[model samples]
Target: MSQFWSELVHNLDPYVPGEQPKVNNLIKLNTNENPYPPADSVLEAIRNATDDKLKLYPDPNADLLKQRIADYFSVQRNQVFVGNGSDEVLAHAFQALLKKDKPLLFPDITYSFYPVYCGLYGIDFQTIPLDEDFAINVNDYGDQGGAIIFPNPNAPTGRLLTLKEIEKLLINNQDKVVVVDEAYIDFGGQSAISLVNQYHNLLVIQTLSKSRSLAGLRVGYAIGHADLIDGLERVKNSFNSYPMDRLAIYGAVASFDNEEAFQQSCRAIINTRETLTDKLQSLGFKVIPSTANFVFASHPDFSAEQIAQKLREKAIIVRYFNKPRINEFLRITIGNNDENAALCTALSEIITS
Candidate 1:
């Protein structure tokens, strides 16, 4: 809206993140953040990193963290690329790999950020619609000489595509780069990182924010062919050499160190997600089969907006996208035992009344 703004800035429509409530008492499930805290090791490492080292710059390459991620995923250190978050990693990908001669392809109802990134980079793109069940049918994506990207257990919808389906997509589009954003992969779905070694054009992006419970720490990475990683590195270095800070590097490294705590938390969230789905269905909400840390459901008798408003009144918040095809659905994050119970109690009251 400013006269000084460039044409690109003037035409840009920014992504709106989930609301972070001002008060702490509210049960916040709007953003699909993990309900568990970061592993004790992660916190201890971050605290230990706070020293005179704060005066110096962090490793611009983030070699240690990259090696940790690479080892954990069974990929080489050269194939791993770390960034501020998966969002930043994705931004680099869109710029380096996705912007091609043909329009990039993605799901119409997938992550809203994809389109925003395209707009920022001036990348031409096309959106393929999900099927009637809100699931991605890879057959819809024909080999068109353009790049492809989508979430595994797709955002807001929480519908997961199996590994076989993903491999099929990779085979069909062998010539084009395929990016699978696995931000929620650990909750239930298998990571495509397992196949990155097989597919030269495959790039798998993940975040510690969800399953690793490091949303505040802001660490995300991508695993792919060393050549692709080098391309992303070129874009990253050209933009910002120091994307990962000292504390974030140490903390992210520690996150990979404690596999037990990480798996335990993911299991807890999966259990809660199932329980919540059953409860919602019993209350007349048609719940989607979700493999992520959240559930997407719609009530037959109540409106999504009305449910969201009522829940807010009860100090509970869930994500409601007022967009096409999914306006009636609410994306509810799986909370811990007490929080889940409280959410159910609030919903029961609201629906019964």
Candidate 2:
């Protein structure tokens, strides 16, 4: 630790993102990215955005992009907030909405970013553990806290809580904000943004990276009551005036315009996820029912670490968390058909031999 570093930095346990390997021809299923490409319209729009206009600074408020998102979600302009990515949007929320005198509350096994955000902002937080089935129990969240946030179809586990359960949490805690990270809602679950109009305390954040296949562009947005959006905007303006660039804004707008194409891509991934789950189960792995673009599975005969190493030897990569209660499970993203076939083939040989 350097003497120049602040005490906060010394105590922080930074979030380690999934590795992005540089090897060629490797079947990468570690990160939950869409196997499909972005819509043609989105590509055309992005290409068009790469013009002399880029020399000019983008709209600091990102008004046009916000309007497009508002139109798509049927929310008002003031009710929508855009950021560099959902991660940044979530970071802003942790500081603006979750830093209270009381501790923030979230699932123990939820997004690793949540805890990292808490550490970054010096927010006191408490974790609510998921049930034995690896599903979120809404009833367990009846405690005093500053705010609450969790992925709907939670990460790694891919188990989802119903929209009614989310609304129940909002209803029970009317005074506090509840942020739902819907990055994977397009896969197998419904979005909680539908309830944002009814619940003033609800904030639903989504990313174009996963579902819309624009991870490289880095665009994400949040929908909520106008007041909550205003609070986030206040924090955002204080930090950076132009988090969304011109290309990102135009690309995000085009993504919303081609909603049908993106929906089709999501459907295909869901189908692949079903097939992948069945294949893993046939190989004696207990696969969780996934609503996200990935599957979480644990083998009866082999440990998660062993399987990950074997897959790596075959030029395939999947995520393995060396943590408790889930140390035996691997979070494998659903790749394209050929990629999935290769992964299954590699696993079959490893298991058989």
Candidate 3:
């Protein structure tokens, strides 16, 4: 390590995202990204925005996108805060709301970025372990943390925590902020935006990357009480004045108008997820019940790392974690019909050979 680095930089353990290989024609299902293209209208919106507007700075507040998101979620404009992506929005959140007197709490196996954010912000934190089935046990939180945050239908495991459980947690910890990361909530899970008004402490974050098929656009937003939104806005404005660009703002706004494409893509991914789960189970895999657009499975005979390596050799990639309790499982994103079939065929060949 370089001596020029600051103390915080030296101690940092950054989050490692999934690999983005340039290998062509490979079946890539490692990252949980939508395989479908966004609505043609969204593309057209971006094209229309490509004029001389690039020379000028975008709306610092991203008011138009916020208005559309607010209308979609039935929340007021004052309750919405837009960011570069959910990652940035989450970063601002950890600094604004989560760093309180007590330590923050989150599911141990949930999103990996939570801990990285805590470290970056110098916030004290604690992890509550998921149950044996990899499901979040809300009772374990027990009003201990200064704030709470977790993916609704959790990542890597593809398990969901019911809204009732979320409400219970909110009721128990009424004084603290509760952030629900709903990046994959549109697949088979309902969004917590509906309950945001009921719990003033609740903040629901969503992205256009997954459901709206705009991963490249890098736009995400949060819906919550106006007071909570104000706190996040304060942090955001302090860091960057123009988080959302002109193209992203227009494209994300148009994405909200494409209801048919959004619904169709969500349904297709959900269907493929179920089919992939059944196919894996037929091949002696233990597939967890998934509400998200991915399946988490493990085989009794083969280890997760072995399976992952074998798939990579065959140009098929799926996510595998080396951490405790989940090291044996592979988190496979649901691809298109042809890609899914190819993965299944490859697995069958690997299992037999």
Candidate 4:
């Protein structure tokens, strides 16, 4: 290690995002990105924003974007906070709301970024194991943390918890913060944003990168009580007031305004997800019940890594983790109709051969 590096840097383990391969015309499905393009109105809004406005910094407050989000979620602008992406918002959250005397709590198998944030901010955290079925049983949490956070439709497994279950944790853990990272919530699950007004301790974070098909733009936000929002604001202002660029603010606002297109795309992904699940099951793969835009499955006879390698040889990519309970499973993103068909065909050959 370099002597110039800080102690934190020397010990930090960064989160590994899935590869964005440069190969052309590949059936890319490793990362959970929307296979559909953004609405035409979103493009128009970004194009319209390419005027003399580029000469100056965007409103550091991101007033119009915040207002759009607040109106859409039925919250006040003061109760909302926007950042370059949900990852940035989550980092600020770890530093502000989660760093308490008690250790933060999350699923042992989750977004994979939660623990990284804890390490980055020096936040104490403990991992509660998912139940035998790879599902989070909210009752097990039992009010033992400074804060709680997890993806609703959790990553890798794509399992979701009901609003009733979420409310149970929030009610029991009212003394501390509860952050719900809803980056994939728009696909088929209900949002915890509906309960933000009821729970002052709850902060629901969302991103346009997945559901709105705008990963390149990097826009994400959180809805919470004004006090919690203030904590994020303190951290954000301490670092950089202009976390969101002019284009991101404009484009994300347009994404919120184009509700019909966003919903339609989500519907498309959900439909394809169901179809893909059935196709996998028919081939003897035990696919988990998924409410997100991805499916996690594995065949009883074949290994996850073996299938992943076979798929890769055919120019298809899917996620295979060599971690604990999930090592046998493959996490496949639901792509467009053609892409799904290609994946199905590839799996058929791989399984039959």
Candidate 5:
């Protein structure tokens, strides 16, 4: 904390993303990334894009990918905004819309990044408690000020709030922005993108990381009214004209193109998640009902840290949060069939022994 740094940097508490361990064959299940590989068409598109075209700059606006997302979501191109990843899209969003006269509102337990974003942007914010069962209560937001943002099927917990409940909040707070971070929407939750046309203040953020199996490519987008999209575009242009490189643009467009493959992958994850939930419950775990590609659960007989540590010793890894409200839970990403089998076997030994 010496030297002359920007006051913003000095005052920031950055978001720490889940670990991407370098160890191979560890049965990684911490990050909610898709366990399957991306569609072959996405690979081919990236390969085809890596050409003499490298000498030329990508469309500063990433027009092709924008058009693809626009068409897929039945929105005009002007109503869509793309970025290197949803995190960046969210950064642009915080700068563009969330800053307000009153403190922003979010769930006390949410995508840990929300508070970090607020700190980074110097935006005042407040947290509302999740219900006793950890579900979002839209009625509690009636006295709120400023904007609101939260993951649809909230991270770590994997519990989803219905679109109807989201609409209630939007209707109640019609004057302020409501940013629904739908990063996991494709897994099972209904998208608020469908309601964007009805609510001008709604901005639905999504990423290709989970459903498209393109976390490596880092492409994310937002769907909203033209005015809301334009605000993000202005902030993005001011920050980085080329948030997406050539390969990312091509690959993201291809991911949207292969809609069938994307749907198949998401369905597979959902199926595996259901089976895993049963296995965890049989092992005496209380698993949260998850609509995302992960499950949050814990055994009544064991500590969350112990479960995570035991799994690590077995060369399996999942996430364990030591924070409040849900400190006893473990967030396990739904892996492939074989990986899930390995996890189940590992948990059987770990829990019993």
Candidate 6:
């Protein structure tokens, strides 16, 4: 809208993030954030890091945090790349690996940011539609795109694809880069990070924001072949050398130190997600089988927009996308016990009324 804007800027369509309300009292389930708090050790580490060292710059390479992540994933330190968040890590991937002579390929119903990143980077792309059940069928990927990227338990839909299916995709498209965006893999689905070493072209991206309960800390990373990591590093260094700050680095390192707390939180969310799905099904909502922290469901008797609005009135918020093929569906994040109970109560009231 500005005269000073470049042609690329003028044509860009930005991604819309989930709303963060001004008030704190509302039950916020719109964004798929972890309901549990970060591990105690993570908080303690972050607090301990706030010292006179704040005056100096954080390590530009973030070697210690990279080493911790590498060790956790059973990969070499050279194969791990850390960034401000998975979003940033993904941005680097789109720029470094995905843009090519052929068009990029992704699921039609995927993280909306994929298309946005394509637009930002001027990368040509095509979308492979999910099946009637909102599940990805890897057979449809073919060998056409320059690269491939899709979420394991895909965003908003929460439908998961198995590692076998993923391996098949990798085999079919051996020549192209395949980026598995595992932003929600910890909820129930297995991570593709396990296969990164087997497939040199495979790049797995993950965020601490969801399962690790570090959305505020803003840490994410990628695991891949050392060459791919080096390519991402080239893009990252050209853009911003110091993506991870001191606190984020130390806190993320501590997150790995406490596996028990991390597993406990993931299990709790998975349990809540199943309970919420069953409750929605009983209330006449056609709930998709979700392996992520959120459930995607639609009530045949009511509009998704109406349900979202009514829940908003009750101080509860869930995501409702008015896009094609999924306009009637609502993506509801799994909250804590009390929050889930309140959400069920509100939905029950809405259904009965």
Which candidate order results from sorting by lDDT in descending order? 6, 1, 4, 3, 2, 5
Expressed as tens digits, the lDDT of each residue in 66-134 for candidate 6 is 999999989999999999999999999999999999999999998999999999999999999999999
How far residue 196's Cα lies from its native spot in candidate 3, in Å, is: 1.1
Question: What is the C-alpha lDDT profile of model 4 across 1-353, one tens digit per residue?
Answer: 89999999998999999999987988999999999999999999999999998999989999999999999999999999999899999999999999999899999999888889888988889999999888998877765777888988888789999999999989988898989999889988999999999999999999999999999999999999999999999999999989889899999999999989998999999999999998999999999899898999989999999999999999999998989889999999999999999999999999999
Candidate 3: pairs in clash: none
How many residue pairs in model 5 have overlapping backbones? 1
Return the TM-score for each candidate structure.
0.99, 0.98, 0.99, 0.99, 0.98, 0.99
- Candidate 2 lDDT, 1-353, residue by residue in tens: 99999889899999999999887888889999899999889999989999999889999999999999999988899999999999999999998888988889998887888989989999999999988889988887766787888898999899988999998998998988888999999998989999999999999999998989998899999999999999999999999999999999999999999869988999899999999988999999999899999999999889899989999999999999998889999999998899989999998999999
Q: Write the per-residue lDDT of candidate 5 for residues 1-353, one digit (tens) a residue.
A: 85788777788888888999998979889998899999999999999999998898789999898899999999999999999899999998998999998999999988999999889888999999998777889888755678888899988788899999999999999999999999888888899999999999999999999988999999999999999999998998899888789999999989888978998999999999999999999999999899999999978999999989999998889998889878899999999999999999999998898
* Model 3, backbone clash pairs (residues 3+ apart or across chains), number: 0
Residue 118 error for model 1, in Å? 0.8
- Residue ranges of candidate 5 with Cα displaced over 4 Å: none
Better model by lDDT: candidate 5 vs candidate 6: 6
Q: Pick the candidate with the highest lDDT.
A: 6
Report lDDT per candidate.
0.93, 0.92, 0.92, 0.93, 0.91, 0.95
- Evaluated against the true structure, the overall lDDT of model 6 is 0.95
lDDT: worst 10-residue window of model 4:
138-147
Which segments of model 4 are wrong by more than 4 Å?
none
lDDT of 4: 0.93
- In angstroms, how far off is 179's CA in candidate 3? 0.5
Off by over 4 Å in 3: none
